[model samples]
Target: MDTASGLTYAVLGTGALGGYYGACLQKAGLEVHYLLRSDFDLVQRQGLVIESPDGDFALPQVNAYRRSPDMPRCDVVIVALKTTQNHLLPDLLPPVVKDDGVVLVLQNGLGVEAEAAAIAGPERVLGGLCFLCSNKVGPGRIRHLDYKKISMGEYSAAGEAVGITDRMRRIAADFERADIPIELAEDLVLARWKKLMWNIPFNGLSVVLNATTQDMMANPDARSLAEALMEEVMKGAAAQGRAIAPEFVQTMLDHTAKMKPYRTSMKIDYDEKRPLEVEAMYGNPLRAAQAVGARLPQIQTLYQQLRFLDAQNRGL
Candidate 1:
């Protein structure tokens, strides 16, 4: 890739996560093209409005396109879309990604990188685990709650460890230039499992019980339940040869305890009657564990509950 200023970036999904990161990059003077949907006209008119704890800012004029085909081929294509909309990547990716450009899967859940690798080629794929608390409150308006760090790593087609690379550092430089903290993960598989240690409990319980992080962490019973679920996640990770330290669970708990009270992305989807990413976030992890003969009863129960609630919410 090129230097932060020289490389052009395309944000494929301009929602909370995409819009916030893309806006930061553009504000830092990087060339960023946003592929917008519902907020296209508004962002094109007013630009993106970011309400962040660090400070509020606005991009008065942005390079916005309603369709991927209309966008300029970029050096880095950031796929920040929700996994539910991933089916669109077949059309959205090829039209905007240069022959040698890389696609950064800035998404949640496990095995999502594979889908992008299939479209963009394995060597041209990277994974980003966004540790951000943000939401799109209105058209072109994104509210950044807390936690704005990303753990990025390269994708290995053979499922082997790809240690830190110059390519990874180059990408990290761009994000760091945008004032975003970047942790270069040596092992992407272990990093994904670590992220799941937090996502599985908070994302699911928040929707199932109608509680925020504050509510869950404040109540003794809810706090205990969350920790128990996290332990099961560790067990599942170990089954796959990823050994997360027991201390990591407490670290996650403490982090969430300090986080601002906010509704999770899954909860927002549930409230909006959109399809929950039950399959990606829950079902996929469960299956992975089961394939290795790991028994995760608590996680299995939560997954089933989310499945039922997702169906009922969507009227499926």
Candidate 2:
């Protein structure tokens, strides 16, 4: 909670999303500690390297810990791991979060807040959505394709629980000072759904077609399919009483066009034979549609096809 002296931050994943933000914070002169499995030695020896379209950076002083015993308590902890790794969090998070510390769930898709809260406690959980397009090109190296703003807010209904404490405000200020666009929102649910609306179509289609965002958008049939899926998602959102403007979907597609040649994390996972986040990004929304009695035939078809593709890609 000491804003003036800078806050202690623990980055849990140390992958593309986590590493980029952590490096930015370190550049801003904040104290940052990263928890890793075995790459601590590599990062320690060669430093954390971030390659962006703007340029590249190497943080030589990046601190890393291979185990909980080596991690110090921090004021804030960023959870940037894959949703499939949620089970590991109960054991991985406690050592880094002080009783009063905040743990920010920066993963993609919905339901992470509830899952993180169940483990870290609602009072200590915050939700964050990163807009950057990035990937872990290799151990100790992260490639940032797009540098979008970061949106954060309280995970609990109380609006200023463990996640959006005064300390988070200070951290956001520091991020802004470091030239990282950061926004604080009271209605994080809306923010989350807004991000989801973009992900369900783009993430799913990219993986299914084995293409980048631009590639998907370039094909007329693929672009139409994406638009159809987005319409279904919008209907589902409306049923939830969170109607998104039609223009919003257009804007998202436009944004992706500008971010051409970039691949989504789900696509990367599929290529690397890692477990895809299809459930969180695609399944959860379909469930919500059913819950709200919203019919989405097109999305249902796309989801089924994508699931099959995902299964084949993972040999599951």
Instruction: Specify the highest-lDDT model's number.
Output: 1
Question: Can you give the lDDT of residue 262 in candidate 2?
Answer: 71
lDDT of 2 at 182: 88
Give a tens-digit lDDT track for model 2, residues 1-316: 3343467889998988888888878876788999877678899778799898767888977788888657998988889888888888888887888787888889887667777788778867778888887878888898888765889888864323233457558768877866689888666766777888778888888887778888988899988888888888788877767768999888988887887587777777888888888777777777877887988888787778877887887778
TM-score of each: 0.95, 0.90
In model 1, what lDDT does residue 234 have? 95
Candidate 2, superposed: residue stretches over 4 Å from native: 1-5, 53-55, 157-168
Q: Mark the regions of model 1 whose C-alpha exceeds 4 Å error after superposition.
A: 1-5
Q: Report how far off residue 314 is in candidate 1 (Å).
A: 1.1
lDDT of 1 by residue, 1-316 (tens): 3456478899998999999999999988799999999889989999999999999999989999999999999989999999999999999999999987899999899888888899889999999999898888899999998889999999887666798988788878888999999999998888999999999999999999999999999999999999999999999889989899999999999989988787888998999999888877888889988998999999999999999999988888
Relative to the true structure, candidate 1 reaches a TM of 0.95
Which ten-residue region of model 1 has the weakest summed lDDT?
Answer: 1-10
What are the RMSDs of all candidates, in order?
A: 1.9, 2.9
